[model samples]
Target chain A: MTEQPILEVKHLQHIYMKGTPLEHHALAGVSLKINKGECIAVIGHTGSGKSTLIQHVNGLMRPQAGDVVVDGMDLADPKIDIRLLRRKVGLVFQNPEDQIFEKIIGDDIAYGPFKMGLPIKEVRDRVKWAMELVGLSFEEMKDRATYALSGGQKRKVALAGVLALRPDILVLDEPTAGLDPRSRNELLERLKTLNKKENMTIIFVSHNMEEVAYMADRIYVLADGRNLVDGTPEEVFVEAEKLREHYIGTPDTVEILAQLKAKGFAVRQNAYQLEEAANEIIALL
Target chain B: MALPLIQVKNLSFEYAVNQTKIPVLHDISFEVKPGEYVVIIGHNGSGKSTLSKHLNGILTPVSGDVVVNGWNTKEWSSMREIRQKVGMVFQHPDNQIVATIVEDDVAFGLENLEIPPSEMKERIDFALASVGMNEFRNRPPHYLSGGQKQRVAIAGVLAMKPDCLVLDEATSMLDTHGRNEILKVVRKLNDEGMAIISVTHHMSEAAQASRVIVIEKGRIIMDGTPREIFQQEEELKRLHLDIPVASQMARKVQSHHHDFNGTLIHNDEIVKEVVRLSQREVPVI
Candidate 1:
């Protein structure tokens, strides 16, 4: 990649319970190049190492025999200042309940900045900005109990916690996993703003192909702990059958086209969404 | 008289948060038939969750009857029987999990019932196999992915052998892979004759189920098959739900080409339908 990627995962291998018979090859020779401001979406079935792979980026999980290099700091290097790197390359987990620790929303948002030993004024400023960025009102939500917030609010607060650190690269594991339509759209919009305005590079791991198709510049497909495929969403989803054989459902548009074609109907396999498919149908008529 | 699996007659509930009993659900009434799959859709604060909790008597209704297999939930005397018959799987897997080991957690419900040792083993094995989690039987719960852990959680309830399963946004916490995995299990269970009532925000996912119920502001707006519910796309949009991506694309193209054939909600159908029509001697166009 040009000028060395912002985040380079080189020959990364991770084995759970290594040496024991119960060991799993969570990641097998995975190497990826993520440049600044690029958003990459990783899609796979459950137990396909999507989460395991992301965890390795922030020293959350160390590779068994390889390294995760972010901005020249080798995560495998014991002497590397992990705390500094963690602050810069922040990780937001899928479940908000486990990640958010403090009682109040403001306190939880400021946890990361406070840990970095920032001045009180700066930490407070970072927390407020982070809260507003996620679209949580500062005055109303800040003083409220964290437990009082709805499921969507908890997620926004959890994200604010990570954003307060001002991480250059953000790694979110299924960030919109269970949000309703409005909340999901809001989160995606805010993320887009961050990527566009702040030049933040993002590695977003999601299972929703539509979201992946809409958001990512690149897509990675994982299966059986192997990097099965890698390309843009457009390129990756074109292989509808292969996607199905791997147990990853092709977006409805792709599947419908494949089915129609198999049943002696003429349709393009690459067409994924319903609207396009409809237009194509109408045109044929 | 043949009793329904679960019946909520004019159910209303309020949560006293901050000493304020906020009315969450009002005048909710429905019945889940034995061996039926019913999908519930609504935006947040639409009382979907509040209603789900009342299914298994997790939350007692304040103003009406929640009858489970002919037992009134307000009378706590029969709660043990009600819980045994109406098992639930919550949205987040981590919160509901009680044991560290996968198999042990799966056996938790059985242990509470004091199932005989031999019977427990038999049930546990069958449950694990049913959800396709037999291999991870010995692994710890913490190590499993959100979807896998959810399967284990399902196994936990399957071992109990409930008459109906209520998944309250269970798939929301999962990635596409996880969502599909759980959906497969849920569908299979429904086919095998267990009553399933799933509260979800995914229209595509709702399309897979036998029946769908749409609610807004704690009132039932529509109840029908996916075809019927989705055909009223304009209404769904009003409730902040989205049409499948393919359908939207089809609609978009239709605005340009009125000659396109068929009801296009997904892409492939539109393409095949189009090409087929265009190829005819007296072309459809």
Candidate 2:
């Protein structure tokens, strides 16, 4: 808490279709502080303001009210260099089609660095490095057709395209969605390595509690455009009863442990991961 | 025995672009019995979505045939009959809702079939109530959560009075809570004797169905009861699919203590196993 957080949002508020009959408050009084090299997950129902909040992190959508500061750059200030800020903080949308446009994989990845006016060698280096980082072979994938790749490969390409910019902070919206379990695990592992090796700040929005429990260093639960809870996975998941009030769901591990606790068993209710809960229950036996 | 609700015979599909035929599904075949809940799982690009499109006559097979409720999809005239018999719910709920109000959206499909005004009203109310969205009948589609929106989409399809429901990754775009909400509604409808065919990426969701079908490389690779299919964990992993978390945890726990002997799929099953072992004072280091 003492260090200047890498990303901070103060009382963020947003209203969609403002001043109209269909007007809706997408975000309301939401605040967050995320540190460098930490992987944070924002969990909420579909309309719980998760997307709206993350949209503000990279200044994709300006907040109607409130403030967002990324690495000392205030998003509320119109004078700030919005383009430069985007380079420092990359945002990957939920749909792969929305991100991948170029026919060739290499061209799509080089788009960001090319747009930055980086030298030819630097852009080529970044594209190669990103492809390798996401486990895609540069030589093979660079010239391959983007649409011909499988779903998992397309997602990897999308991720590599964002990583090509070498952003210090990366924000992804449902990065593992629509992927098989193996691909989901692979993507999570790649992100963990980036966070550990590059000291990258990761802020991802997800609805999968199991992934959040496994990946997030800190978790935030949003409800009705408000910050319902924010804590470590263990702290937030153990509050099963409270979470239900916000329509928040927990992973199967936590749900099982909570059920045992409610049934008067001498079980550890705070275990969030399956292995941790499994080990705890084994000890009880 | 009653005729299978749907039957696919050597179904094959390919995308024809500029005289190049790119195969998406390969000789896929299956049958869904009345009131049965079947879940199809596969890695992305495994052609599960393509298969779903064939069930409702959205896409015709290139070299095979699909019969839905005794209607051949190949016949252009039977397209309407096939579509009406097999109500399809897609991944994005936002795309399916055609009306501003929930009730109006539910009535849209019925109106297309030229149902009488009195019948349309009754169908709309019944469909909304079936999905537990009757209370939000007056609300705008934009105002509902992802899960609620999906339920409303289901209601829209339900009003068509389909005998079988085919969900093509319908819950993929939702959060855990939203996904569960959709699954619960689907299961309830199945219990009410509506044949349900769900295509999903979530391993846990597949574990709950009456049957699990695994598609790989555009073909049906495996199909059996959940226990039968999940027992082949190594094979599933080879296909880029993951076993349910509880199933994996059970294996991990069994590695330490051989007392837990069962194919655990649900969280409750693992909890019960641990509880049974604890009563017997199984040695724990």
Question: Tens-digit lDDT track for model 2 on A61-154?
Answer: 8867988999999998888899889999999999865679999999999999999999999999999999998889899879988877766788
User: With candidate 2 superimposed using the best TM-score fit, by how many Å does residue A263's alpha carbon deviate from the native?
Assistant: 1.3
Model 1 has fnat of 0.64
- Error of model 2, residue B170, in angstroms: 0.4
Candidate 2 residues lying further than 4 Å off, grouped into runs, are A15-25, A63-66, A147-153, B279-285
Give the best candidate by DockQ. 2
Query: In model 2, how large is the Cα lDDT of residue A58?
Result: 85
- Could you give the DockQ of candidate 1? 0.49
What are the RMSD figures for all models against the true structure?
A: 3.6, 2.6
Return the lDDT, model 1, position A238: 79
Every candidate's DockQ is 0.49, 0.63
Report lDDT (Cα) of residue B20, candidate 1.
82
Fraction of native Cα contacts kept in each candidate? 0.64, 0.80
What are the candidates' interface root-mean-square deviations? 3.4, 1.8
Q: Clashing pairs in model 2? A: none
Task: State the weakest 10-residue window (summed lDDT) of model 1 chain B.
Answer: B259-268
**TM-score winner among the candidates?**
2
